[model samples]
Target chain A: MTTEFATRHLRRIRLVLWGVVTAVLLATGGALMMRSYLLPPTSEGISVEVATIGETDIRSEFTLMDHTGRAVTEADFTGRWQLVFFGFTHCPDICPTTLAYMASVLDLLGPDAERVVPLFITVDPARDTVPVMAEYVAAFHPRLVGLTGTEAQVAEAARNFRIWYERMDDENAPDGHMMAHAGHMYLMRPDGRFDDVFQEQDQSPQKMAGQVLARIQESQDVK
Target chain B: MRVLIVAALAVMLPLAAHAEVVVTDPWARASILASRPGAAYVTAESDEDDRLIGASTPIADRVMIHAIETDANGIGRMVHRKTLDLPAGEAVDFAPGGMHLMLMGLSEKLVEGTTFPLTLHFEAAGEVTVNVPVLGVAASRLDEGSK
Candidate 1:
């Protein structure tokens, strides 16, 4: 072959390779720009994308007995927002205090309380029987519902909620034992999806109510 | 003679310094269906500094002092308190969500409307007994504030 023809072929191959590299670089830059747009950098300079990528929606369902000994399930919590707490009636401090605080929050919501249901699910089912729950709940808000089921049923509900609770046996305890459980309140959406969780300790009723109402309003805006 | 006088003064000093522990609005939550644990709250004050070492009630097998606190995991748990400081001229309130006298193993049901005897033991004030009215389970410090 002639030297001129060989040089022309080599230049053409080099030009084609350069074009491919430029196109690949432009495509990658565009994709990264789109991702940055979707997830803005938080104050910590870390995009929420990394956090959301590993997060899976929590869909939990369980059948339990209410204080009245009536059978209820997750379906019963439909059509309204549910604020569920896991605790026992014998819980001298946190349980009643949390209930009272939640009641105050619901009261502050006023008529809006109708749209929310406060639930107290006992982690110590062995002691918190139906009658015990009935009296225990009546002491709190009228809108509060106390639920206690069999050991297996309670365990299933706790598992679905992904909460940790263990019966701490104290020989000196008045009830013969105590249940050490998570103290966060779970806020569930009308469609039975996990919405938000609130820590009851040291949090005022008004602030918690504001957070809950804001979330509900945000959810409504999305719809 | 000076030694005798000092000895007498020493004996009378405790009685002279026996600051009165005033317990007001003393109340307790009525027991629910079964005889479970209950808590009693009171506003205590003294003319001089005193420490509430312990509390007791005839209705319970034993009375305990407990404070509700959030642990490292942010979970609320009850911690037994050995003593509560009460400064002079300042009222210390044992209210819900804070410190309270836990009545364990009630001898009788703390029914609403009934009154039970609660004795408060202080370091310098000796023992002061008060009748704690049993209010409904929903009663709290705010409820007493209205009255």
Candidate 2:
């Protein structure tokens, strides 16, 4: 009789233990679902994490001539946000594709785009002259500015921006040469400070515009 | 009689296989500058395994198949490919920022709304020419609306 009583007591204890374990699991699962539901939506597969200037040694300083044959420096664009891209007109694929993407980004920004200046700086200054830059930039967007300077000037600008470019010889190319350059775009603040960098993979127009708009809003908030 | 019939079937089979390869949606990005090279993309499908050996066009001095490869640091470099395999029953796409036909020494600017002829040479299919439409300077696809 005593053994029967002990077995019955043991079964009751085991049932209570299982009940506690199931309650814990259910609570954890509910919390996870709530966390996912509360999180902000992300763009497709892109991460919305903003990379600030503190992480990199990027600076905004350049002395180059605009497509209109006017000499300008970073100081001229101190009051406006800058979107910079480095490429050559001889580039058949990536350059044109990227320029088009920039144009779309500007369009998506609408009136807010007025506060942004998109600059296309040529890494191959030897072939990309003022006239070439003018016609090329005009084809994409009227507001888009093409910058080219002397070899040393362009090199200095590239160095300040931490851009790496090299001329590769191709016997079959149009000019018997081609240029390979870093395909990243830079976003700078109105105060002429580096703000963020967008890699080639993050070329979505909506996502890019949203990121830029967020920065613009954040700057205003600080003011 | 049986041997003669078998030889005739052998010759007809290769010809039928060659006829199965089809190229569609051939288009080229309009050259922003006439002095710069142009890029063209197309979709090729084959019923039998074949190889894209070469391509040619009267508008360009040299036509080369090129691919853009990005390094770990996101630097893009163009690599020339001698040949590309087209496996049976699969479609191969040559598009922007990917495999493309580099049209070197363009005779004239590729104007929008215009079409040019591009001849593709295959290892088994011989030569096939398709009229390629010229899209906008920044056009990614033929159906993409004006931006």
Q: Highest DockQ, which number?
A: 2
Q: Write one digit per residue (lDDT tens) for candidate 2, span B1-147.
A: 999999999989876655467999898898888878899999999888999999999999988887755557544566677788999989999877677898988999999989999999998888989999998987976677244
Residue-wise lDDT of candidate 2 within A94-178, one digit each (tens)? 7888888888899999899999999999877878889999999999999999999997898888877777665544542222223
lDDT, model 2: 0.80
Q: Which stretches of candidate 2 lie over 4 Å from their true place?
A: A1-55, A172-182, A199-203, B1-19, B71-74, B145-147
lDDT score for candidate 1 against the true structure: 0.73
lDDT of 2 at A51: 13
Q: Which residue pairs of candidate 1 clash?
A: none
Q: What is every candidate's alpha-carbon RMSD to the true fold?
A: 18.5, 15.9
- Which TM-score value belongs to model 1? 0.70
Residue-by-residue lDDT tens digits, candidate 1, B63-129: 8787655657545455667788889999998887677788877888888888999999999998999
Question: Model 1: what is its DockQ?
Answer: 0.14
